[model samples]
Target: MPPIAMPPGLKLAQDVMTPAEETELIALIEGSGLAYTPYDKGNTRSSTSYGWKYDYANDSFVPCKPIPEGFRTIAERAAAAAGLSCDDFAECLLNRYEPGAVIQPHLDKPVWEHVVGISLGVPTTMVFREPASGEERPVELSPRSLYVLADDARYVWQHSLPPMQGTRYSITFRTFSAEGLRRLEACPAEI
Candidate 1:
């Protein structure tokens, strides 16, 4: 498939992480002891949320296990590479995609302004669809690469990952909006 045309406010950095860093990050996530849940009711991928998890049942953000320290460095680097502050993000979601797993096209919730994703283990094609025009494009995400979505890319397009041939992992970092933060603070769960 042809690679996607780059959209405004979208940035992709290939081979952003060293092999050693990737290995260490993988080990840290696997050993973190946080339970991985299905991406949704029946999605093939499993994921664990850190810092905050949206409670669909409650329609609010709730606290989850804190992000591991090992991931802090990765987040910092991603922020710096994206021209964002390290403090800009306060949550992360780590997804593990087994072979054949796929994520359907969907826009991220409006609660976050930007998203930074780090790909690991295997390369995969991420598809983006323009909401109004419905034009689709594909972007290859290589192992140890980083991709950032902000502004139009974050709010106007929908993104998805196609079924993979090998296991792959993605760490996505996001910052909560002020209203989201207020809702998080009002959640019954302790932060």
Candidate 2:
């Protein structure tokens, strides 16, 4: 297990969950949504290319859909450890990949109580670069692990997945707003 790294304002815990927990989460997300669209992806005003995001900002987002029993249990524990109530958090932004798929680097826009993610299935490299300086840190996201980015890290540094060279499963957990939820319901995320 890798010690949680607090680089500057960033807080990263590589192995937050057990292996069994990871397997259960993958099944939960993959089985939930039949048709899927691009998530957390975008291109900025500049020429730099970015990847998709699971924008819960829209109303079409299935907030209560993907919260598998096991996942919610884990979230509760992690929240307690962090001294949070968990009730205030938003829904899970689940992302599934076959192979050779990748998400680009970008900062998480503030929307929920915290920015959370869970990794399962085949291991993947999660690279974090200092949002401004470009210094990079690569961490292997293992099964059933919780990755929490809060406070400074959520807005300060940039994190992204390398090309999904091999098939892997991941469910990114995040929080959203009632207003944003209304928007998602009305228009839904284009990505």
The TM-score that candidate 2 achieves is: 0.68
Question: What is the C-alpha lDDT profile of model 1 across 108-136, one tens digit per residue?
Answer: 77777668999999889888889899887
What is the alpha-carbon lDDT for the whole of candidate 1?
0.81
Candidate 2 on 56-107: residue-level lDDT in tens?
4452433233344656776785565455655645555556665666777878
Pick out the ten consecutive residues of candidate 2 with the lowest summed lDDT.
Answer: 43-52
Global lDDT of each candidate: 0.81, 0.57
lDDT of 2: 0.57
Query: Which candidate number has the best lDDT?
Result: 1
Those runs of model 1 whose alpha carbons end farther than 4 Å from true positions after fitting are 1-4, 34-39
Task: At residue 128, give the lDDT of candidate 2.
Answer: 77
Best by TM-score: 1
